[model samples]
Target: MSLAVALEVTPLPLRHPLPTPPPHHVGQPPTAFHNPWPSFHQHSWLDALLTSRRNRDFKPVPPRDQLVKIVRPEWGNGQDGLKATWIGHASFLIETPKQNNNEGGGRGVRILFDPVFSDRTSPVSWAGPKRYTPTPCTLAEVPEVDVVVISHDHYDHMDAETLQPLYERRKGKINFLVPLGNAVRLHGMGIAMEDVTQLDWWEGVQVTVPTAGSVKLTCTPSQHFSGRALWDRMSTLWSSWVLECVNTSTTATAPGPASPLRLFFSGDTGYRYVPSEATEDTVPVCPAFGEIGEEYRPFDLSLLPIGLYSPRHFMSPVHCTPEDAVCLHRDLRSKRSIGMHYGTVRGGISQYFEDVTEPPRRFREACETAGMVWGKELALLNVAETVVVRLDLPRLADLDLEHVRSSKHTKYFGIILDLFDASLKKTLERLRLNTNSFSATLCPSLSLLAQMRKSSAK
Candidate 1:
């Protein structure tokens, strides 16, 4: 299907405009943008350089043998449960659970986030922050995608080398969702304006996939600056995103009523700023996260950044430490979270101080301290690893009595009876009930017992 014909976009109106104008439009000419919160602080270049030089002794890259294991993705025609594949760094491919299509077949919607597959994250590829770890899979290995979401214009998160070819390969069949001021860049990549949807924070758009069901993508706030070049720092907007499955099919053959899935992507954000001379608790944190949690709490899954936060005084304003990531997980009320934006690349100079493997270790420890289980509640997945969660299951109420009475479904009914018998035994044991006495009381009528015995014999 044509890109325009395959995707339908509907703008979601906000209840009210933000109290303060979005940071990207704070100035009249809008030459630059700024973090709106008062607690955000940006250090001078000289201080950052001096700190980087002082902390050069630590290992910034792991040995080849210690690198994350890469696995080939198995998408299964996108008809499975909700699946997310980590493509290294901040890139992820998220597929919703199977939903019925117009052709009477089942398919799932696929969304790609901030794909950067270039060797170097820089304006020019020859000299910059080269990837210490390689992409889990090549661009060609990635399955067909329906939507591409860009968080910002930062080199590490957004690479022209990746986006251009990705757009071309899809033949502009992909709908691109990006923060405000980013459409111009996609246009330069040969993407048509109609295929791109730019949204400000709090604004959302419902996208209808021609083959699959619909999803809602919302541009949410992030405490970070954006720029690919020195002169144009913060000229574009940066944001996190909330993706929600809206309309899944509820056919009679489906497992049960459609249960929507909600996912949060913390593109790159700081939970709270930490200064060299001050402790973290004394400083104020960006209130956007708390507000986000209140607005969209209880996410089924969340992808949170958890690395490149060394030289805390400088990096804490933009990057989240592993501990900070744990805090964000709680604030967002996520059921499960996976760490990202770490272990993939190290900058030439800027983010070279932190030990390469420290993020996941710290993340585990922090989750433990917060009374959360490591793999159960929050985790750091191996690169290219795929995680799947089933969102719909058959409930007791969903069982059709008439269908169960039919001869074709008698075997299923028998299985259900076996399950009920096992459960009743467990419940009786837990309650310390006398099985014989309970059975006698339950069937007190002798006539009913005789009738049941006669029916069984017959």
Candidate 2:
């Protein structure tokens, strides 16, 4: 089927019960959105500004080398694994695994999320929060993007400077997925309305890519408000997103099991509200995340915000502290998550209180506290650094030992055996499984198994 035709016909099956709708202001535009629960406390912006000048010992902007590690993103034709490249705050280039096409080789569908490549994340170039960290690579260096997924209309998350050039460079071939009431902004950029897909909370759309098959994009709830300027507060909607790769290919050409790859983008969200001097333990937190975890448990990868949160009373309603992020990671039931939205641009008054480098440290400490291994269950990637996850492997428990012993698909057993430790080898020995019976070329190296076991023990 043609890509457009497939998109129109293939609606993703609702896998779980639909979530409750977000509260909206009555008599306002239907797009005027609010969080599911009350998010803010009594703290005001004036209080944040008044306290912004407090002396902080840590540098807001770290040395460039230590802050961003530049590397050319290696996006191998997405035939095997899922890949994500961190392009600084709240921006990522994600490629879903691709199935083989009529052509012998092909690339995966590339989705760029909230790409802000400008020197400053402001409505006006002369002012607002300027980026202290440079982009790992220039926009020109970014590879071909198939779809652009925007989380909101915030200047930091959405930039006209980046989108306009990106539209022209790609010659309007890209599809844009945005929250409600935000399409007008893309329309203003001269993009055809047909190319933009605007979704409200709990809405989903399937996009078909010639190389990647079908991918489902869902507009999920986030506890955040949105506006670009003073008067437009709550005028538009804000959202998080869920992307899942749907297997539509009749031919099983991909390397991994047929299990779909799912990802979550926590655009910009807060877990709960914390009043000044009050502990977060008893406060009413946003319940959307737990609902999200219920609907989409075990996300293969999740990109969550972990910075720009300070003066917990004010920022916690919109931004996530590292500790809050850890809770969010657990709430979403993410298998692996990477932290973003810090170490890029230092925002205005509210952002001054937190050290730029503090987020990652706190994130690491929080992960450790949660018993989640850093770089395995959760991670903080360097700007421009690319992380790849092997989506083909099934969980260790999913493999049947009898099948491994009797079936011709011993190649999968070899790969699975390489992922565990001595215990797994001992299990194989107890079963009287002979290594000589398996294909030597198909088995992964023993070093990987040892490394995995070592990492697991920690």
Candidate 3:
């Protein structure tokens, strides 16, 4: 079978998925995700360099030796757990709890996301945005990384310098998941094709993690462009990922419904359009995030990009502002969200005119504006700081019931559609009359469904 078929490709619902660039481009495919706004023309590098030449206000000082201990995962138990360690920028060491407490079962599966450890996030060693802070730990220091997830082909997100050493340390045992168009890049970097699984938007695959049972990985859409070089801009795809880990067997014959812990990694994204900039012609649509929440609500934890936004006209179309990140947190319906993609590298337009620390401050202000309590509803971790959270697993009965309900769609299909349909004025009006019963009906299952219905009715 072809690689696309092998990867179980599921085309996104986008009217136009990729860009329609000029004719001369050979390597760039039409499958890339497109930005509906006018095509982006990057600012002149010379102008940017000249603008930022002497501006280094509030440049962060490197952190002291406050190190987070890296632990090798013990997979296979049902005891649920979740831990995240921020290395720097978008790099994170995410650990899912083991299902079993048995001595040999293991701790859990460990994953690395957008891991860039090089001194610079550029092609050349001497010139580029130099690292402001040291890596929390070297690639070799990270325990056996069962999976390495790359959001896109940007140098900051996909550093071959880090991947090479990591592959050598793991002896090429790590399964690398990347965007569909990135296989050739990994292959060129000496990573084997068989060891990599490339996916498009909405496509997913299940990989067994030795003693850790199964983890379902889905390559979801991100509203961002990709290309390591200027010439190859938008040639490859960029994406966010959903990693769901289950301690118990996920097979049809498994004795009970397994509670799975979900982690939504918001690779790097920006809003489709700023709410203020949106007009009647553009309804401010970002279908992917809403669909993601519909299918995978109550994410145990989420890592969202909250930086690189400034000079709103140019960056707002590509990089998310702190407010946009807050909107995404609510869209994803995450239990907790953390800010990323800031403070380590300085290349975005913001650095020229805005302080490097502005992103986090904006993030705090946005969260407070939305009535979300910081440190509880969302968090901002320092470099190398690790936070461990125990997840409350969904009941086996709820899991099984959802499956059964989904299978028998005809039974409640009409009512579901009517309740959620904005055009059905009478149906929504009726829903408000019995909020308690409606909420209770979906309480043990899709409680959010009821909440959405009530909110809409109001």
Instruction: For each candidate in the order shown, give its overall lDDT on alpha carbons.
Output: 0.71, 0.68, 0.63
Q: Considering every candidate listed, which one attains the maximal lDDT? A: 1
Model 3 misses residue 316 by how many Å? Answer: 0.9
lDDT of 2 by residue, 277-341 (tens): 44565566677776776677657778999988876666788888877776676566566688999
Model 1 ranges off by over 4 Å? 1-5, 28-31, 76-79, 101-104, 251-259, 348-351, 393-458
Q: Candidate 2, TM-score vs. the true structure?
A: 0.80
lDDT of 1: 0.71
Which pairs of residues have clashing backbones in candidate 1? none
Best candidate according to TM-score = 1
Whichever of 1 and 3 has more lDDT, that candidate is 1
**Global CA lDDT computed for model 2:** 0.68
Q: What TM-score would each prediction reach against the true structure?
A: 0.81, 0.80, 0.71
TM-score of predicted structure 3: 0.71
- 10 residues in a row with least lDDT, candidate 2: 409-418
Local accuracy of candidate 3 as per-residue lDDT tens digits, 20-56: 5522224445545554333223445575565455443
Poorest stretch of ten by lDDT in candidate 1: 396-405
